[model samples]
Target chain A: MSHTRYRVMEAGEARRFPPEAMARIEKILTRYPTKQAALLPVLWVAQETWGWISKEAGEEVARVLDLPPSHVDGVLTFYTMYNLRPVGKHLLQVCTSISCHLNGAESLLERCGKRLGIGLEETTADGKFTLVEVECIAGCDRAPSMMVNDQYFEPMDAGKLDALLDRLSREA
Target chain B: MEKVLTARIGKKDSRSIDTYLADGGYTGVKRVLTSGMTPEQVIEEVKKANVRGRGGAGFSAGVKWGFLPKDTKGKPIYLFCNADESEPGTFKDRLLMENDPHQLIEGMILASYAIRCRNAYIYIRGEFYDGARILERAIGEAYAKGYLGEKILGSRFSLDITVHRGAGAYICGEETGLIESIEGKRGQPRIKPPFPAVSGAFAAPTIVNNVETLCCVKHVIDRGAEWFLKIGRNEKNAGPKLFCISGHVNRPGVYEAAMGLPLKDLIFGAEYAQGMKGGKKIKAVIPGGASAPMLTAAEIDDCPLDFDGVAAKGSMLGSAAIVVINEDACIVDVAKNLSKFFSHESCGQCTPCREGTPWLYKVLTRIEAGQGRMEDIDLLARICNQMANGMTICVFADAAIAPPLSSVTKFRAEYEHHVTQKRCLVGARAAELVTV
Candidate 1:
């Protein structure tokens, strides 16, 4: 609302550390001996503020942590957890690793794709969901594991998936 | 033999400090700090307990802690809990931390004390957002209760614990790669010679330990080393071990038992996996995470699920993440899937690993699609052999070869069938081999 107090209105371009986020960054800095070491956590805070790390978001992170943009890009691309582009409201990651593959992962992913009317790494037109295949989320104990944003849904099948997707769609 | 690491798992309010303390959680760390047991004594007990790492490598935890320099010349020692549990079939650490966060906290405190670490961090993978929140809450509780921070329990021992989440690089599980990630750099591993123990995390002497291994330190202190030696199949591989049984198991989950539980027993035992799904016939097993070579059904018959036991049969007990394959699965399909995983996860640090992983996956894909030549089978082994054993800065190249090489060796006939017959051999889509 007040453009005078903020550098820019965007999450990444204007790398605005909300007072709470700034406090978190300060506390994280105390955890490490150097400020640069707080880059990962600070970047995480940025990602949490924004849905994904855009080019401007990456540059803002570099500027905040005193790291070069190239370094931020390199670090951002290396880790799969950090999203490079905007994601839909819900991001579903299905595991197709050895354990999950043995279980019906391929078919499970196909079900999600067909039901959502989107292929792998695609977001629905309504901007409600994005489906992608991830390596492993350490839920091998319950094979055919899928992650809905941050929550783990295990032993996923077509029936459970349909019900779950119906519920997500029904939500405002 | 009783549950050590998983004792608090499945209990009511398990993640809370109140429940943890009521169940005697931090008593191990309290006993070590208050009982006048020197840091050296704690390290000695861990060494005697013979606790091997649970994160794939199975190296001795005590021996790893002992590698810290006797004199750091004023640099504060650091302790990193490797929570990057990305190994394909491993998920025990996630269960441990999610259910019993204090168990890991207590274990890290004891381990930090043993190594004179002033600052400790849990480098958890970012995918484990649930676990990170649980641990952050647990650590706050510990600090409020004086189990962590300055003058812990008024015993003159001071330490701080932080949870650093990895963005999502599998290589970060490698100790050096983890160190680099923590330093706000790419997850590419640092060259060895001056290992993490000598200089790591802010260029200070650091000790990186697996989550389960740190959790084991609490028990080694609680019950004493001799008591630990009595539980397992043998003294060399002792203490409670968590084996992650995935795939076609009827009751697939994390089963903790005395070390050296026979491989077949874990698969067919009443208490473990309770046999394969639909009583399907076993074909092959990945004895340890994706890194360890798979074992044929015959080779796994008398196999023991310990470091030395699994090794005796040709595969290392790398994380004890047992993934079973029944008669319905295709071996070529399995190898190709694993190769694709390796190709996707390669850190691109080494020439051979960066180039060779996708090459291996491409060849496997060709074979699985009924497009492989007979010579491609031998070529697979040749490509695998060149990528590992000092071919890279880290052992990642070595691990990327496990699936391809082992399958080619044990399931040669299956590979031959795929090439000669131009299709899979076992799955529903498989065509019968024609001898013309």
Candidate 2:
């Protein structure tokens, strides 16, 4: 395969991973009934340490989990949470379920799209916010809801959303 | 008027099938069959009631029923009841099946009649062993009573309601995936376009609804649509809903409440959630079900409990399984636990979900293990960004990714400290933290 195309975690950064984390990764390797079972959690740790799962980091998780790197890569790509690239600080998750749709969630999404200056799957240029249209957040009674940085903000309107952005911006 | 949704499970006396029949169980079937009520009238009544599907997605039940092709060339039509109550913090379906099996049977009969189907299947999860048995017994009872089987209620309608058990896969809760599993296939999702309405079980027209959704049909007809519409607080979305409350709440069971009720009232009010356990204040809440985004303390205040209200806040009013998070619970631990579930449950069908869930889990485990870095938090966010959008067949992939992404984003400093200081902020499972 071509090593030039894949992003590799730097050695300096790898060295900064807490020794205990490395030890725990080793422990996770032993604790699992099978090495493959440990693959997901190991990649999770790598993604945690690196901010995203790079191809190199994925290979390392694969090694620790005692599986092929390709297997790890496949698992990483299947879930929506495992980011392969960089993203902004605030992750905006909008629910686009049936109830949300009826409750004008689409309009809220449009407003968010316009304000964030990015499409549904696109991240902002400044890497401050990445707008995402997610599946049901399961608060149908509170339709037109959103999760900013994992905290639920209900009954959002244009005004409240703008304020939320302002607050998140300050925090970021 | 004891709200039927959360009534005692198999009270066996007053609420048993015999009691239910005495109180007019299978009467709807009789009424529909004898009263000459066409399927269109039943569907129209359901539409007027504005009844929504109770299984996570609040799609109108009547609208869904209307979608089935009016006429088919004698191809078997199927009515599927989603008894797969696998979503974490969701238990109402199990309770309903265990308690009032007759209500469900009647609902299935009515639903089957409206959809012009001969066979109906109640796909219960393997874990709900007792519930499945109860349903089988109920089906047997309905058969003896002549409500089900060839020539139901002595009318031309003959329906067979089968109780099929799932081998424990959450993806089977999805309609198409459920259909796939019903056919004895490996429970993975099929692409849309040939939706269940067009090509469902055995490639015949099918209608899949939650157990609660099917049950609501009985009420929508018995009480008339106006009475049903009057129950919910939201005019647009009507009908009573069951709130399954767990985690840190004083009353951690299912409660029936009008739609559009505020979350604060549900959580803090004396009779509702009644605050957290041990008299502790609620610090956070996963307002919908497990998959809904986590809610902070301030945001929990006065948030409405309906689909529209939840959507307004960028969340969803999913199955309405309210999971309360107390002050002491570490957000990282929450993320780690949720990550473990999605990772284990991933069908390994889609590339992103199959791989991303475990990767997200690893990062969360590392952080919880006191090995997180500043970049690790961002990396968590990055993976969540990638995994949370259109990456898989169902929302399970998104469900797995959102928690860690949200946790790291919300509590970055805590994660940063764990990495820098080499310790979990919370003492729970500290040894496991170091065990990789």
Q: For all candidates in order, state the fraction of native interface contacts they contain.
A: 0.82, 0.00
Task: Tell me the tens digit of each residue's lDDT in model 2 across A1-172.
Answer: 1111234344433323467668867765543234664454455567567777766677777666557767666555544555666657777878654334435677899998898789976778888888876544443445566777546687677899889888877874
Q: Candidate 1 lDDT, tens digit per residue, B365-419?
A: 9998889999999999999989999989999988889998988887787899889
User: What does TM-score give for chain A of every model?
Assistant: 0.89, 0.81
What's every prediction's RMSD, in angstroms? 4.5, 18.5
Candidate 2 global TM-score: 0.70
Residue clash pairs of candidate 1 = B56-B318, B56-B319
Worst 10 residues of 1 chain B by lDDT: B427-436
Candidate 1 C-alpha lDDT tens digits along A71-164: 8877777777777767789999999998899888999999999999998777899999999888888988787899999999988888999999
Q: Which candidate is the best by DockQ?
A: 1
Interface RMSD of each: 7.0, 13.4
The deviation in Å at residue B28 for candidate 2 is 1.8
